[model samples]
Target: MSAGSVPWTDLDSLDIASLARRDGEKWAVAPSGVLPAWVADMDFPISPTIRQAVIRRLDTDLGYPAWFDESHGGPLGEVFARRMLNRYGFVAEPTHVRLFTDINQAMQVILHLGTEPGDGVAFHTPACPPFEDTIGKLGRIPRAVPIRLRDGEWQIDTDRLEDEIRGRQGPPCRALFLVNPHNPTGRVFRRAELLEVAKLAVEYDLMVISDEVHSDLAYPGYEHIPFASLSDEIAERTITLTSGSKAFNLAGARCAIAHIGVKTVRDAVDDHRGVLFGQVSALGVDALKAAWTSSDVWLEHVMAVLSRNRTAVAEQLPPEIGYVPPEATYLAWLDCRGLGLREEEPSDFFLREAKVLLNPGPLFGTEGTGFARLNFATPPRVLDELLRRIRGSLGC
Candidate 1:
């Protein structure tokens, strides 16, 4: 779709009352009249194509799904392979692509198949909670590599990362959990940065689980370099997990795809699909297919709205709050240390006084203690009210 044809208007214009009635976690988890800017799910409507596809499926009688067969890759796998090639120029064979209910499940499966208990999985600090949580639940150690904010830009401290890999306390570092267009920070990993990570993964003999779910949401002037797409060597050790869920507002749809470059890993995951990993819903599969194959126009429109909202958050937020406009995703990681709250977490303060809910920084990691994550994927009017609430609470 051309930029001009893309609908630049705010589509997520639900008022507080309308939002409360919806069943999304963003709304359901919040009390009545309180704005929910906490979760990563967008407040926007589902893409027309995806919605229609789901509706068509609902008309038919539900039955057992044709499970993803390893011999002949299913339609979802083929579509995902085509999407990777067309969007990111990544060459993925359909046979190597496996379907999952979501990225979280995919990660769990990878951890189970790739590493033994007590193994160390290294990921960047201030990461999305799920990454660390998954590691802990699987009886593994979480090795947090801190990302430093250097000269107003968030950067991976490669030296520190290498040191962490080399000087492990317990179990060997088995995997590197890489988030491209990283959550919270929204720093799109540059080609050079990705190559460095690839080098480290190869050197350390670490399995790379690259989460590129937000790769499609990157803003203009920044590009998301798929970690596995760097080289043949990197691909051999990588399992790239991605989905249209984040970009297309399909979280409830419960569908994700993992492009496995290693044959052994692929086989292990496939073998356990029904026994260890549950089957994906037929509706989710249909929605995913529609999203990847025919919803580019809708995605472009949503991106336009998100791009504008990103700017709005920067321009409208109080000067005391520090925000680096994200290069990808709808989340704006706000540094509230300068707000003079002293001991009070910014998220708690906002929720109590401003009646707006945000993800507290500390929840991401210790590095985010004075920070708060704001979901900017809402209507302009709602965003205005959100800013007003924050400003009023701060007495600005």
Candidate 2:
């Protein structure tokens, strides 16, 4: 797609609600109709199917939510499992699917059960800050391996990761934490890349914790290959965490599911479920079921819109910043090392001067310095304003 054909043209007319500069202030319509390209949430309204289901559920008297629990035989878990298996070609038993409030909680649960205080947990550098914080809070050392953009795609230095895992030799590298279709970078690791990483995990007897919240957002012709699908051995060692919040924009509902493929892994997760991750919300469970089973058309439309937006953003960005278009998700990681801004300063600069908020690269990791993470999920008009703000700030 030509950069010039980017969707910015249509986005020039949106009006976003404005918030107070400080907390506890009166909110009013943003007089300027500034675009909000900051948060991952989409500007487009919720899907009609999901909205109707929610409304219908509220109106109907479904007492006690027994449907969520297996005793009552609700198909929520089965629905998600089937969708995942069908899309990724990984077999997941509905019985093996356990509910969680969110993927972050699932990560904590995995950490609590799989590793000890100060145990080494491996992750790619420039990952979500929450990963590092979660590991630290759990008292595990977050060992980061960098994934650099080369040849228009992000690639992990497997040799470095393997060496680091092996060099630690004694601690045995307890777990490898990953974000397939990665967050800020938007680089979808190929199947071969996943296999090599899986091989290392098996060789070292390590757990693989993969956060695939953005899996469903993959664009046309690009498939999201679940890490578990790489091999049976890998499946045994892996815990896949995903949620409908991302693709469906249902994050506020707070529900995510874990698919534990191996008996040992399932047992491990279940054993600690009581202490760490508790029961999911009744609404979240129902929403997830509705989304996974009946939202294919909505999801396809979202993918198409985001694909167009991604191409648009790629076109507007200067080549010096070196960001290849993402294969999945609405996030775009733009390298800004050339822009003479401190790691944390540019995002703030854009927010203050350009009146646009963006995730600073530093928040992701040191490797993310001189980069900025963007959310392209807003309406086209808002997106145009965001690009204009960026262009003004950069004197482009």
Question: Who wins the lDDT comparison?
Answer: 1
Q: How close is candidate 2 to the true structure, as a TM-score?
A: 0.88
Residues 1-396 of candidate 1 have per-residue lDDT tens digits of 221222334475456555566676888889877999999987666777887898898888478775636445565768987888898898887877887889999999999998989888989989998889889999988989989898889999998888777755666688889888899999998999888888999899989999999999999999878888899988899999988778988888888888888778887876776766877788998999999999998888888888889999988899999999989999999999998898999999999999999999998999999999999888777888998999999897
lDDT of 2 by residue, 1-396 (tens): 322233333332334442222111111222243444555666555566677677777887556665434421134557866886788877766776777788898888878877788688889988887899999899887788899777767898999898767755545478889899888777788888988998899888888899999998888777789998787788887888998878887887888887766567667765665534566766677677788878888777667677777887878776656677888889888877777765446677777777776778888898987777888886565566678778887778
What's the lDDT for candidate 2?
0.74
User: Which regions of candidate 2 fall more than 4 Å away from where they truly are?
Assistant: 1-14, 17-34, 67-75, 272-276, 342-344
Q: Score every model by TM-score.
A: 0.95, 0.88
Highest TM-score: give the candidate number: 1
lDDT to native, each model: 0.85, 0.74
